[model samples]
Target: MKASDQTLPLQNGETLDILFRSHPRARRLKLRYDSVRRAAVVTLPPGVSEKSGLDFARRNSDWLQEQQKAFAGQEFLSPDNFISFLGHDHLILHQPDDAGRVRREDGRIIVGGPAGGFEVRLLNWLKKQARIRLEQAVEEKTGLLGVTCHKIRIGDPGSRWGSCSSRKTLSFSWRLIMTPATVFDYVVAHEVAHLREMNHSPAFWREVDRLVDHATISRRWLRQHGPQLMALQICGKSPAD
Candidate 1:
C-alpha cells in the first residue's frame, strides 16, 4: 500500500483499498472505483479533512464492494461467452485445431487453437487488431494536426483510454477496439490533439472537436462504459460444453 492510500473494511469482510485524490477545483467529496487499481478513489475538495473523507468512504463501503463483486463475477474469455467487438457483441467459438488462426465469421469470433492457449491467442489477436487500427488512425490524425508521433503502443491502462507523452509517443488501451468506431476515433483525436497542446485547456478541447465529430456523445459513452471495458478478464475457460 502506498503512503497516500487507505484501507476500508467492507461488510463482506474484505479490506477495500482507497486512494485519496485532492483536486483544487473539486466542489464536493466524490467516491469512485478504480478498475485498474482495484481500489476506491475518494476525491477531496480543497477544504475537506482526510478523516472526513475516510468517514465518507466508510459510509459507502457497500457501494464499493458492489463494484468489486461486479468485476469479480466477470467471466473469462471462452467459447459461447459474449464479447464486444467493434461495439457489437460477438459470441466466442472454439474450433478443434492446432495453429489455426482467430477470425470473425458470421458475426462471431472463432478461435482455432488448443483450449489451454485459447485465451492467450485470442488476447494476442485483439492486441494486434488494436495496434493496426490505432496506427492507421494516428497516421491520419497526425497528418491533419500537422504533428508527428514518436511511437504508438497498445496496452491496458488504468482510468485512461489514451495518453500522449512529452516525447510524442502515444499509448492507448487495447480494449478500445471493442468500442464503437467513433469512440475509438475520438480517443485517437484526443491524444493527437495533445501532441500540439499538452494541457486540457480550451485550446486543446477545441483541437479535439476540430478533429472528430460527435465529441460530446463519445465522451459521454466513455464516462458511462469505460469501466465495463476494463472489467473484462480472461478467467478460466468457459469453452463450449
Candidate 2:
C-alpha cells in the first residue's frame, strides 16, 4: 500500500478501501465514494490529522456500505447484450469484416471488425458519436443562453457528468450519449449556464431553467440511474465474466 492508503473492515464483513489524500484548497474532511476505483476516499486539508480523517470515514461507514453494494451490482457493457441509448434499448451485434466501424440500424448497433478488436472499435465509435452529438447540443444551448464557450471536449471523468472551466471551456463524459436525450440536454444546459454563473447559485439555476424546464427531473434521474451508466466497461467484462 502507499503511505497515504490503508484498509478498514466494514460492519458487513467487507474490506473498506481508504485513501488519505491532501487537498490544498480543502476546508474540511470530505469522504466520498470513488466508483471507478471501487473505494472510499477521504480527502483532507494539509493540517488535518489522520485520526480525524479515519473517524470521519468510520462515521460514514453505513453510507459507504450502501454505495458499495449499489456499485457491486452495476451493469457491464458486453457484445451481444442490449444497452440503453437515447432512452431506448439497442442490441449490440458484431459482424466480422475488414472494415471496423459501428452503425445503428433498426434498433441494433452493428459493429464491423475482427472479433479480437471489437471492443476497441465499438468504444471509438461511441466516443465519436458522443463528441458529435454533445457538440451540437452545446451549440444549441449556448445559442439559447446567449453565451459563447471557448471549446467543447469529451472525457470519461469518474465523478461528474459535465463541467465548465473558468476559461469558458466545457468538458462532458462521453457516456452521456447512452442516456436519455432529455438527460443529455440537461447536462449541456447545466454547463452552458455555468458560462454565465460559475457556481450553483439561484442565478445559475435560473439559466438552466431557461434552457430546460425539467432540470430537476433530469437531475433526479441522473442521481438514481447514473451509476449504472458509469459502470459500463468497454472491455465487455461484467462481474460474472
Candidate 3:
C-alpha cells in the first residue's frame, strides 16, 4: 500500500503539499523538495510511522520553503527567451523556411519549425550537439588515459552531470552543452577518469587534473551555475525537476 500525503503550513502562511513514501532501506526519515512538482517529499523507513515523517517534514519546513523560492525563478525555454548555449547568449529565432534545420549564426540559434514545436526542436538540436561534443571529448580523454569506452550516451539526469558504468559506457547530461567549454570538458574528463579509478580518490582526481586544466575552477563554476543550466525548461519541462 502507498503511504498517505499531507500538507505542512509554511511560515509564509502558505501550505505546501507533502507526499509521504516508505522506503525499505531508508534508515531514517528523509525530506526533499521536488522542484518539478513544487512539492515536498518525505521518505520514511520501512517501520517508521507516518506521524514521524510528518514531524520531520514540519521541522524542515523552513528549509523546504527556501528551496522552493530558489527554484521559483527558473527560466522556461521559448521562442522569446535567450539561452546560454556553449557559454554564449544566443537569441532563439524561428524561421519557417528552415523548419527542420537547427543552426547557429549571428549569435543566435536559428530553428526552422512550426512555432508550436520550436522548444522541442531546439531541445533535440541541443541534445545532438551535446552528444557530438561530449563524445569527442570522451574519445580524446579515453585515448590519453589508455582506456577504451564501449559507448557514449546523452541524458538529463537530475542529480548528476555524468556517469560511467562498469561496462565502460559513459552517460552525460545534455544540459552540459549549455555551459562553458571548460565546464563541459571538466565533466567529460571527470567521467573518463572514472574509467581508470572508478572511485573519487586522490588518484582519480589526479587523472582528471591531468585531462583538464583548471579543473577545480571548472568544478566551482558548475557548483555555482549548474542550477541555472538545469533550470532551463525544455519542452515545458525543467531539466532538474
List, residue by residue over 48-112, the lDDT tens digit for candidate 2: 97788888999989888877887787665667888788878999888877387789989999888
The alpha-carbon lDDT assigned to residue 71 of candidate 3 equals 65
Q: Score every model by TM-score.
A: 0.80, 0.84, 0.76
Which lDDT tens digits does candidate 3 get at residues 147-224? 999989888875368989889999898989889999999999999999999877899999998998889899899866
- lDDT: which candidate is best? 1
Instruction: For candidate 1, give the lDDT.
Output: 0.83
Q: What is the C-alpha RMSD of each candidate to the true structure, in Å?
A: 4.7, 3.7, 4.5
Candidate that would win on TM-score? 2
> Order of candidates by TM-score, top first?
2, 1, 3
Model 1 reaches what TM-score against the true structure?
A: 0.80
Which regions in candidate 1 have their CA more than 4 angstroms from the true location? 8-15, 20-32, 42-70, 236-241
**Worst-scoring 10-residue span by lDDT in model 3:** 232-241
Evaluate residue 206 in candidate 3 and report its C-alpha lDDT on the 0 to 100 scale: 95
Model 2 ranges off by over 4 Å: 1-3, 6-9, 20-31, 42-59, 237-241
Residue-wise lDDT of candidate 1 within 1-241, one digit each (tens)?
Answer: 1235579988888898888888776778988787757788888989998788899999988778877877676666678888898899999899967366999878899989777777877888888899999999999999998999999988876556888888999999888888999999999999999999987789999999899988899999986677667677765632110
What Cα-based lDDT does every candidate model obtain? 0.83, 0.82, 0.81
